[model samples]
Target chain A: MSKYLLDKFLYTVDRDPELVERYREDPAGLVTWWESEMANSILNCHGDERSTWLAFTDEERTALREHDHVTLFEMGAHPFLTLTLFIAMFERDHGPLEYQIAYGKAMEHLTLPYPDIAT
Target chain B: MATVCAVIASTHHPFYYRASTSTGADRPPFADEWVAKIETFRETLTKARPDVLVMVGSDHFHQLWLDNMPQFLVGKAPYFDANWYNEEREFGLPRMTLAGDEELATHILRNGLDADFDLAFSNELRIDHSITCPIITLRPEADLPIVPIYTNIFAPPLPRPQRFVDLGKAIRAMVESWPSDKRVAIIGTGHLSLELGGPRQFGEHGPDPEFDRKAVEWIANGDLEGCCGDVTLDSLHLPGNATHGFMDFMLMMGVAGEGQKADHVDSLDLFHTMEAYFTWYPEGVPTP
Candidate 1:
């Protein structure tokens, strides 16, 4: 179990909640939302990375198996992501396995360590 | 004697005394050891002393965003008493007349499209710190007459990777094609590090030194083939917040030329960062 302090990885999630939310479950919405969201983020960056991130549109997120979906365990997610995950988990009629698998796929990108700087 | 001109570009790393000496505090990698490097660039520029300079660099949210964004912006007007939002470096040049190389700009647009790029043409954007930063640093003691070019690389649909290389070839062809045999030395600015405003920005990355070393090595080896190598879309999506700015270097490279060996003159390493590039030109070329 990896622990994440809030201050470190917060911006990666907080800065783009609306788009990250859709990518978590809404497949159709993910396409349109990410296009504009990525544009906004890339323009703010420094250099070649601008054109670099644009490639995300073509990258298919690798899917996780049904048994592995676990949004609650994602320690670094923004408060909004947790909220979305909660609603999808309890209030929905979908099978528990679907949420489990979906959460797993999304969490991989989410769980990447913040590359913490420790002196 | 050929009339030589300079193109100044850089990371716009600001240095201030009273502020936090932590490099990433005010601006990542600025106040740290790179402070001396930026000052050294100014010194070398003073020594090399070109007659006229056409600065090539990018702008932040300084001029365009949200309400307005120009596809491709160019500023050929004299900028005296320009604005500086952050404590970044101030413009060091006095106001002078500026001319739009409508000929060059038109050629870029035409060639950019022929080379499969979409660029909006404009003559009315404000001169940004990206251009003014290196200008003031290189010639802090005096202001030189200037021409400026801007790219939407920070924005989107950035010209294809190869297009940047062609842009360099196009500009060189255009410059030499012109009757004026100006003493021209092109500069490609920006960095080899990936620390941005993210949390890790306060500290250095383990990978940054490796990245910096590889980049400078390519530059010194005159690896124009590698320098302007394909900046694939996947690599651009790295963690740093400022990775987008490197595209501006490609725009400058359009004029810098291939097989041009860069003799590294200075390198400042701190917090896993290196602010460096090849020499302005080889000894064979008549230097200023």
Candidate 2:
């Protein structure tokens, strides 16, 4: 059941808006379709010495950013998805549920919290 | 009776990819994770013994990376491997010999494009885990043939989600039209998460039960629109590692259809939900 459950978890978060917001003023027009996994993965996608994403990294963060566009793509944060961060900070919190359940094991594997595991 | 099985996609973390490893790092740590993967993939291959395995997934800069990457790319190859290199880790590489069903694959591509879905092609690109993981799960040893599909989740000029859905419909038509008598196995792989990177780590390893519950709800009941949001929905995460290959899954579903009642497999065994779809025909239904 756990394995089956895991698959279900993959599917649920894979396609749904793991993060979003709905305010009375905006109503239907304001529903933010945010994919938490990409945001999470992007957080960990630091750049190496040779990177296509280096130019995008700010000077202060350069030594730390390992920032590469190609890696950024791998983070699942496509250029098209750049606006999600804004959606997240502005919208309601998706929950601690996906994070809560998978966090422990994820930590065990040394797998960062980039892709909100439980979603 | 003839059949062609296929796999689908969504966003996935290729451990060898830059985001998964260190910066300025050219080579990835391969052997450790891959050998382990090959070891396990063998068992599943033994269980669902099929004539051919069709692996459908999205493409990154790997193939087109060298040659102007396209929004959508597909390949019919005799062998597939991942030259995945991690700057930090030793990219333990594993090469697998895959079989190609050119007739079926070509038909599906042509039809999908005929329906106006800009499908691209390459004879020389290697595939990532998007296809390999499921393959490893079933055929850990790599003694079989595979059909590789490319998607546009990562690059631009990608087809719209609904357009991909239509591509799925075309795929269904192409599959049903195949003339060979083949028992095929298709596995759709991807993540079920929208956010990647930063503090949002879903934490690697094991099933996240809450996320698992929501995933089940979407699949079991057929809430495509509700689960996926408006088909017209667009955002940065649209082609996320989790959602990247989703349309591929939908395409397979369209091809597999609900008429055949697929038995959902247990998920805990692996990181993905391996649901078995059915296409069993009524004993007397005369092969269509």
Candidate 3:
């Protein structure tokens, strides 16, 4: 459960317009390509400085590939990153705040003591 | 020495920029009242007649990342390019450029490190909405040079609520001791019982109204002991997942000093979160 890696994917994609569109249009393709290419790259460093060992577990990969926010939340992926990225991709399809409200309702069954987001 | 003219604290709601500016049917029902409240709040800073602003806010994983995050950072540069692409996309926040008070930033960094804060300094920084929201509402001209101080409220292993208070006190002292004729208004923004991207988010009111009520009182009355006694890194989670942002308010409380009542206070109950505004005049309230 590499929450850090999960957040990196969300953070990296959320900031780039092209990545947001690509992830929205093709989640599985983006996830596969991101994992194979961008996941281990040090954000503030050059490409050659990228670390070699950072890889997401199968569950994390599946959650990202499916854009499953509920599962992402339960897995301790940062909720803010997940929500922001999801809203960017999907909010246009729904009415004002419809996507955000629905996103929360989906997690209504979950109680407090929500998954720890510490990295 | 620089005079501490006004110490202000507020909730940095990103929606305010869009809400207050939208016209006709595009504006939300609550926009009018929110604008009125902000106008009144803006007056507190305006009457103080500040020459420079010391803005305190946290980075929302914008420039600072987990790979290397600074608990407290000071932006020391000639200018700061404000708002991010994501902020513009999400909040309709216009891109801004504000002049940086490098002299004040240098003083804070030098004295802050000597004071054992181990502060990090950024030569070039793009500020997010936490700082800009207040600028839009209070100083829309974006005219004054500013020294931006960022705290780490979003990430875990955060500095304790008491630590925020201590830093606030330290900041106030640093400004007061600076050898300058400038009048500095220290402004910081944080949340009050907010829940973002969680089950209780986007509710009719903030997720925890009770917490917001107590938080307002603690800040307005400058009750640092009561606030820190009840608030901790662990206890903050109960009010709302994102309530740690409240520590920035505590930091402002420290600048206001313990038991010093705020000169101006107001609040607005909005859908997602409550907006609270406070201003303290260390040198008595200025007459308009």
Candidate 3 chain A: 10-residue stretch with minimal lDDT: A42-51
- Per residue, candidate 1 scores C-alpha lDDT tens digits across B27-122 of 544454455766656655555555555556665545554335665554534342343322222212234223344444554456555655555555
Interface RMSD of 1: 16.0
- CAPRI rating of model 1: incorrect
The residue-by-residue lDDT of candidate 2 on B1-288, one tens digit each, is 445443222223344233223435443354345334433333333444467666666653334432255655667555566533320122234555565667656765777677776777766667766676555445545556666766665543456666555555565565656677875655555444333332333334313334444544454444455444633324423323334444555554544443333333223212322222212121222222
Q: Please provide, for model 1 over A1-113, each residue's C-alpha lDDT reduced to its tens digit, 9 standing for 90 to 100.
A: 12122211122322344533544466445444444454335445664454433322221221111112233233222222233233333325465235433443454454334
Q: What is the interface RMSD of each candidate, in Å?
A: 16.0, 14.7, 0.6
Model 3 error, position B74 (Å): 0.3
Tens digit per residue, CA lDDT, model 3, B197-255: 88999998999999999999999999998998999999899988898999999999999
Poorest lDDT segment (10 consecutive residues) of candidate 3 chain B: B194-203
lDDT of 3 at B1: 100
Query: Which candidate number maximizes lDDT?
Result: 3
Q: For model 3, what is the error of residue B210's alpha carbon versus the real structure, in angstroms, after optimal superposition?
A: 0.3
TM-score of each: 0.57, 0.55, 0.99
Cα misplacement distance, residue B236 of candidate 1 (Å): 2.0
